[model samples]
Target: MNPTRRQVLGGTAAVVGGSLAGCLGDPGAAGGDSEGEGVFTSFFTLADFTRHVVGDVAEVQNPIPPGEMGHQYEVGSQAQVDAARSAAFVYLDIPGFQNWALDSAENLRSNHEGVTVTDALANVELREIGSGHEHGDDNHEEDHTEEHEEDTHDGGDFDPHYWTDPVRSATSVRTIGEALAEADPDNAETYRSNTDAYVEELETLDETFESELSERSIDTVVVAGHDSYQYLAARYGFEVHSPVGVSPNAEPGSAEISETIDIVDDNGIDVVLYDTFSSPRLAETIVNESNAEEAVAISSAEGTKQQWLDDGWGYVEQMKELNLPAFKAALKAE
Candidate 1:
């Protein structure tokens, strides 16, 4: 069963910055723009939501640049201090995925008194990456170690890609809307109305995905990137197998790579799925080495918001385009 948005937000209760609880009343008490320069966050998607809600009231700065993968971003000392100094509020993922963002938030809050930090996942539930049920004991330790390395390397706490799932993403949008309204009370009505409309659109997208992919024949997918896809896997029925761990930078061991090839071959996988942030090289290698004929790039939409915007692909549209084919291929067996 899909968890409620409230359940997802509940997960962020563990986030640091005890200050967030009190500031929820008036985020603007620190500093927010009546006109411009309302910084949103590390992930471009959050900015997308902020734009939808805040509308013309505030312009958001999505600090992370294009092609700069958030999972591996390292904030410099001066950069961290500067981001804190300039922005009124800093929105970030609290789970291990954006630990660097969280670390930056902590530094910013401690240094400057007014900047409010909001966790995107604070109200969104998390999907476990490569759940143990599929990988078993042999891969459990390795997965854990890889998750740690990814977390340390990027400054994330848990899995930061919670927005991959539409349900959680809608919740995030609402949260941002509420925060923006609080930040700038004058435009509260507009923010609230925008969020309501966007949330409705999100609901439509979720319905489309559930209807489209729910009856598909394919059940298992093999991926090389290992940048997390738990939300998508959980939303649909597919079991995702990856050679690397949470951090896409982590290389898969030769043995694991071989094992993934065997799994793909043994299962007669129709295609190898790769995401935007991942190197398709390993997937290509596996397909070539195993003599598999099919391969495709499925957007996990991680670190690819600009591409989506540029391509005129919104969440529902992109997911449908990228995922429907795989489901059609996989479900054909049913």
Candidate 2:
């Protein structure tokens, strides 16, 4: 179950953080007075976004290990304690996605007097698991939607994968930028300017997706794993069919698998999409069972540290390189 927004807000007292020293010109410098203060993010995606906005003005810290899935990550007591002591702690307020951070919000505030805690999703609009336009067989969609609705964490009703949509992710960039500016007033202009530049890039990315997907004939996609691409689908006017629901932790039963296979066969889905963090077995099964010719990896932006480092793929790059191509081939776009 997911936590309610009320529960999450109950933890907030007031928002307010500090100077570390490090070279302001070098973005890669370690945390210190010369560099700036430490800004802790709950996941790599947020950290990546923050880095883009803050540059070398503040040192961004993403405690979640590279390659580890952020949704399933459980912060240790020591780590939690240490994070609370940072200059600013940025976390997704989506309850089910980052339950530990939501639970620790109040504690993080109480224990650390000067630390600022910002909910990156505070101003972003979130989607519910099955709230958007429906696709696929009516019966199967209903069953899966019901299952997702029941899978709550403090009673919240939103999908936390907004980063999958570059346009939607711009909202987060703004939220994070404002938080950073507030935390370090000295670099406020830089943060705002950087955010504007990044948002422009995101807007361009959104236009590309709109133009490309609009020209595609196929309107449905089958993901063998969880249905994390709902935001992308909704934004671009496509329907996503997945065996599992929104949360990756929720396992699909045999009946669900069979239904997904049916969707693949009926739609002539050429490629089954799977996230980098998911097991390929389910995608392989669907491909083998149906006429689907292949399977491809679509990053959910929850990639491991080593993968991101090795690939050097940023959020926009992942969508442009991996997701866009996969969607084009799967949909048989011109």
Candidate 3:
């Protein structure tokens, strides 16, 4: 639950002291000015987009920080606490790409009663496995976890990887823009303008993906890690084949593992795509068994601190690198 706009303003402005810093710029990792207009506590990838959309109006703070692994992030540190305390509003993906964020949001709320937490997944409609568009059977392989214990092989209740789809990415930008406007009314117009520009860029990215990918002959099977790419699979007509579900931490059963391998064999999938944030252990094993050459890394919703900063990569550039290669490869897959 989020605090109202009035509550954030009228209540305590006791935010943790910090300056605006990015993953690549600072020596200590998290560094910025002690003073700023407002704070946006974002998880990972959305942080970059929020920064772009919010521009100078708000300083974005990532709970998981840059250079850190998003899947392995846990709460209970001074930095996390300070970020929460200072944030006027925080963005959380309820289905959850970040384990710490789920717990941290609650704890942050308890300490900073005025801090507003918005669940980005709340309004978006979700799709079941093989439900969105059928290129073939929904051969999505996922890791075994309590969340997937009753897993109907469905995409599960929470696929926090929604940003894989540019449309959803654009939607998140709008949501952040609205929140920023509410938090800083003086800069509302700026936020709107920023969002409009970013959305146009996303639309163009979507066009690029469709124009390139739609021409491919084999749309049936694409292999990647679990829970990271449903939005992408849905947006295009390709079927996602994964070795694990959304949580990279979850271990798939032997049977589930075998099934995924079989698909890679049958579909002739050549590349094993891993995100920049996660280890390629599972992807490598899958490649070994399926004879799919080797691992190819793509940026998930967010990227490593340095990767985001080094490449001067933002949302659009990241997506282009992620999907374009696959689109070209799919064309080659006979």
Candidate 4:
């Protein structure tokens, strides 16, 4: 009943200019050393992947603080300063997704000679965020007004949810390994080895998803918040329907909510999945109005929750424990 299939995920920058430019200067000047100046990632997910690749060879730091959305969190210039002191900054360099990161990466490449900037999104064929009523009336299209400033970062255009797809993430694991090996050539072997092991796990996860979702009673999964599962849907052959589009800030209108409820009723779906990061009111309403019996929580893993950290639930755990069961229930997969 499924119709589909699923690639590699590069870009690393080398900075060779002035002496680390003030705070990000040399060891003595910048108050940093090889051990202290480790790899700094843009957010939790990247940090998790980078940590796996580095394997204690180099410390991995996520500049985004806890309880903050990685896409829209405002850390001002502190993240740049901290990252500049590191051997590398790992972040997706796609424009509009993380404009500040793009700017900061450029700064590191241009001014910080000791730092390496790697764009995890390099060579990735990003999907555009599309609009329409998935199972609703064909004549109704959601408004694309003066919002969606973060298509990926929190806005629209190319969907920046590739990390959600384990197949693509396996490729990203290698990309990070390559970047780290290049940054610290002495441990290139270790980085490569770690990357290989981690990638194997990711590929296995991809297989789990494929095998689990291949034969499903339903073809679509409806979310009550902003859609973050395009990569997952595309990779696994299911479509994601949501009232919200790219921007997390945008609120769903009454019409959108009514249609999403209609979708749940039309599909005979019993479970409604909601982004853990977004408010659950919309999902609760959808469940109340439709035949859906329960609302489920599925995190994107872009940020972390205290409980998630307490349980040591990284990206893989989040996907398996949270998303996997939710999809299995909603899609009625065998």
Candidate 5:
């Protein structure tokens, strides 16, 4: 006999414990988990997108606690072991962003006979990290130590924050939908239809971003946090200047900070943008030193659990509410 929904979720809670308990809860208790089939994802944004595509077809599980910055997140051994056994396990294939997932993906596939593993970024074109912001001044070439370069993950060759770009995000949705459909063939049609509708919504969001950003007077956005918006910047034809590279944990040197300040001052930027995951101290420093009048928080779609519950926020909703407005203010868009 198959285990009940409560039994499965309770078992998951017992295995993972601590943060996982709070993150998983009862699978069917809320957020469209009525179907009782398990669809586990590595992070919150992917969880939200999977939930949107699967709807009532499967119970989506996002084991990462809300407000937890994904790049810095380390999954417990027991939790990884348990999660590898899930019916469907979805994760980004990007290294360093979710090192645990990348490290264990192959092992999970080998061990979990029933689990379907999906890489949402399988087809998306990832932006190379060092390609952002080339200063033409004397501060252009700062020699990063070999250790720092390794710490920044693969010499910052690829940006993993593809979800920030709606077009890429839609591709992820399609990838996830196909994976889910293949995993549960019985509900394949439903999954595909839902994905189609969700993709349409994302395409509409892409249109909105293009229309709004094209009217902007300013083309440069200075972020006080890590550089996670390369794909978004590339998509919309805006320059993103940041003190650090992709990982929030990668600390910027004083020279990089000075360069960022110079960029903001030279561009007459009025707003400095900070990501939700990183500290605002750097943003404050940049704003104080530059012509930027204020700092705004932009959601990287990596939200806290309480914020999501309180606001009933989803990926698209967050992009529209937090990210879009922040960009508008930062870029001086009409």
Candidate 6:
């Protein structure tokens, strides 16, 4: 909001832009950056979803550099200017996740009149942190949308990872479709058609997860890694237990580690699942210290891995190829 502060920030971005570009690979050619430039997003999954909805209508750019995790990436000054200059800036609105992005979204709304700003989570129902962590048989409580509408960036009451569920992802897709159409009204029809097709794919993915994991032998999502799978757990009626909490780099207390190990041994959980980006040391410790056969890495789909980028793995690919298998192993699904 302050002119002096903004100029300082933008100047910083211009300085970092060149050097970072060298390490950032080809923005348009690799991973989720479907085209070199057009509609830019906050991170990988959002970029992928934007690409599907935009189709050939717009080139979706990813701001997070190659191999850097979205949460950890420090957004440069140029990224904000780039977003403001683009047709639209689509971003995740979760609090504490990427506050810079949230600020940029607000600036676009207040300062930049022409650029469209879309919050991918706008339509999706949010879950309270640890909403379905209990063993009780119940769906999550309603989202506190109204209460937190004014300060959506405030980091309480809501979990940040809503895209982990395909059903919620459908809502996100439609929101993006609407934003793109708003930004480029002439191609509304094309964006609508593209969005519908993508939503259908998301629906299919939801069905697959439901049917396969509905009657899994294990009803709990036991992980030694990150707890980003709360949505997946809530959707399919599974309790969640992760001693490391929700962060990949979190260090669990000894008691927490002991409890996680106990869950593995007590439930006879075969696979100890870790967030793909996390160090395997903790998971390895859990596996070696408990009855778990091995520690497996499952993606949160927050950022694109280098290998996944090469393989062209997108949201659905991560869900099907990586997540489902890790879940099957952890849940002992037949």
Each prediction's Cα lDDT score?
0.59, 0.69, 0.57, 0.71, 0.69, 0.69
Error of 2 at 162 (Å): 1.1
Model 3: pairs clashing at backbone N, Cα or C within 3 Å: 15-86, 19-32, 19-33, 20-32, 20-33, 45-302, 142-244, 142-245, 143-244, 143-245
- Candidate 5 to truth, TM: 0.81
Model 3 has an lDDT value of 0.57
Taking all chains together, the TM-score of candidate 1 against the true structure is 0.76
Please list all clashing residue pairs in model 6, or write none if there are none. 13-77, 13-78
TM-score of each: 0.76, 0.83, 0.74, 0.83, 0.81, 0.81
Angstrom error at residue 18, model 5 = 31
Residue-wise C-alpha lDDT for candidate 5, range 14-103, written one tens digit per residue: 011111111122333323322223667888888889888888755787767777766658768865765664556677655457766655
Off by over 4 Å in 2: 1-36, 133-155
Those runs of model 5 whose alpha carbons end farther than 4 Å from true positions after fitting are: 1-37, 132-156
Query: How large an RMSD does model 4 have?
Result: 8.3
Which parts of model 4 have CA positions greater than 4 angstroms off? 1-36, 131-156
lDDT of 6: 0.69
lDDT of 6 by residue, 253-282 (tens): 999999988988888788888877778888
- Please write out the lDDT profile of model 4 over residues 76-179, one tens digit for every residue: 78888887777677787444556667667667766775566666654444665684212211111121222334344443345667788997787777777776
Better by lDDT, candidate 3 or 1 = 1
lDDT of 2 by residue, 39-76 (tens): 77788888888889987665788878877777757778
* Number of clashes recorded per candidate: 19, 23, 10, 6, 2, 2
Candidate 3 lDDT, tens digit per residue, 7-47? 22222121221222321112122443222234545556767
Best by lDDT: 4
Q: How close is candidate 4 to the true structure, as a TM-score?
A: 0.83
